[model samples]
Target: MSTPILEFATDANNPCMHCGVCCTHFRISFYWAEADDAPSGWVPASLTEPLNPWLRCMKGTNGKTRRCIALTGTVGQAVRCAIYSQRPSPCREFPVYLEDGRPNPKCNELRAQVGLPPLPELPIAPANDPDGTPTEPPTEPPAAA
Candidate 1:
């Protein structure tokens, strides 16, 4: 199942400072079909490089620097994707949150590496729901004197 993505949209709940850490933290590879040259593709064909027969990755990200060509702006201050709308699945599918609306742990790790802060975890869901698991451990009832 596909995860919901903001795709250059600023989130009020998990506001990103445009830290750009994630852009430089990992390789961004996606299926070749996502490139503009392919049928129904959107990612800019010129911005990608072939990884294999079936895979492609954004330029700059494949090299040692790991920064994406599409990213522009000062990391941790202001930044944006050059091809937000036409970005590949790896970009669009990157998650700041989980299916139940909680922050993704991995996203925070990249941010921390750059001296940025972690996204705050959301309030617990209703205990009855599978997503309702509390972040904090349950407290013991007051012991009777």
Candidate 2:
């Protein structure tokens, strides 16, 4: 069973901890070799659909909603990736922010599409964000404006 991550610790250090707009905003496709049966990270084949012989995409992401098949819980509140440790390379590489603490343009664009505000270019949950992104997906949307 997929245990929802349930809740995240929100604080002054992280602004994006509660938002999950990007997981439903893009096509999460990756090389077929990235599947569980391969040499490394284990995205399950059953939760994916072939995009091409060389590429497979997370099931929900290839559809109209674009939500990843492994994503759990609500989008603007708490959410988790059911197969987080085994997620494919594309997910592992999608940055919420740039290396210098600027918000990723694509991330902000996706958030805007969902009525979530743009992640700030500076001071966006910087603690433990080695690559300018949160280690976990955002856990809550910004408080109502």
Candidate 3:
């Protein structure tokens, strides 16, 4: 089965911060159609090397240690994605799991490489019914001793 689609929520308690692991550690390739949809001068044609006539991937990821051309600032210091709003679908879909949820191993590996701890499991959201009602009523915790 395919992985579940994860939602990105910025929380004060969240651990992610300019880690740049995903941007520098993986080959982010996608269909040629994606490049065409990118705004003029956003994802420059020259910066993308063709994986095939129908596919193209961003350059600068040929080696394991190479960083993406769009990455700016230091890897673990204060990095940022130059094209965050216009990043490819792959970038948008990179999971940042919650404290009780399943792990994204690749993401955790990158974190480990940078001397950061693995992300805590994501908390499972409460289930909803077909009509969007909560499957069970909310309950308060038992009284503390």
Candidate 4:
């Protein structure tokens, strides 16, 4: 399913701080095509397990947390996908939003967990970021109840 671009303003302060929460919190599903290519240099050198063509589940090593093997970087630092450019199609399109041009509620949950205020409602679009990540809708600031 192709995600339509929602028109919304970019939050200047909403830069992805690379908290790695997105990677650690979710099980990144990979496509068959992504597994065909050789692992990137950034992939952990110690991991010799062959990529499972039908791999579906992803969990952190040593019971740390659930995350994609391509996710790299230190906690609270710069975290990013090692093979971002060549990431699987599913990985390239995450946080699926509604077709009505509304932001996915799940995204708000993520921002809250990451210490970010709710984002303003915005349209979704094909993220053209250099990282090749998908563009998410701008969430509204949490209501001041």
lDDT of 3 by residue, 24-108 (tens): 7788877776774545434556667788787777788766667888888777545666666656667767765522354677777
Q: CA lDDT of each candidate?
A: 0.65, 0.65, 0.58, 0.45
lDDT by residue (tens digit), candidate 2, 1-145: 1212222355323444356676787888899988876687388989888898899988888877678878887776566677876878877677665655566787767666656677654443466454555355455445543
How many clashes does each candidate structure show, in the order listed?
A: 0, 6, 9, 10
As for candidate 2, its clashing pairs are: 17-138, 17-139, 17-140, 18-138, 18-139, 18-140
- Candidate 3 stretches with Cα past 4 Å from truth are 1-15, 37-46, 98-100, 125-145
Model 1: clashing residue pairs?
none
TM-score order, best first, reads 1, 2, 3, 4
Q: Better model by TM-score, 1 or 3?
A: 1
> Tens digit of lDDT per residue, candidate 4, span 31-101?
33344344543223233233465543333532346665667765334555665555555544654344544
Residue runs of model 1 more than 4 Å from their true location after superposition: 1-14, 124-145
Model 2, position 33: C-alpha lDDT score: 82
State how far residue 73 of model 1 sits from its true place (Å): 0.4
Q: What TM-score does candidate 2 get on C-alpha atoms?
A: 0.71
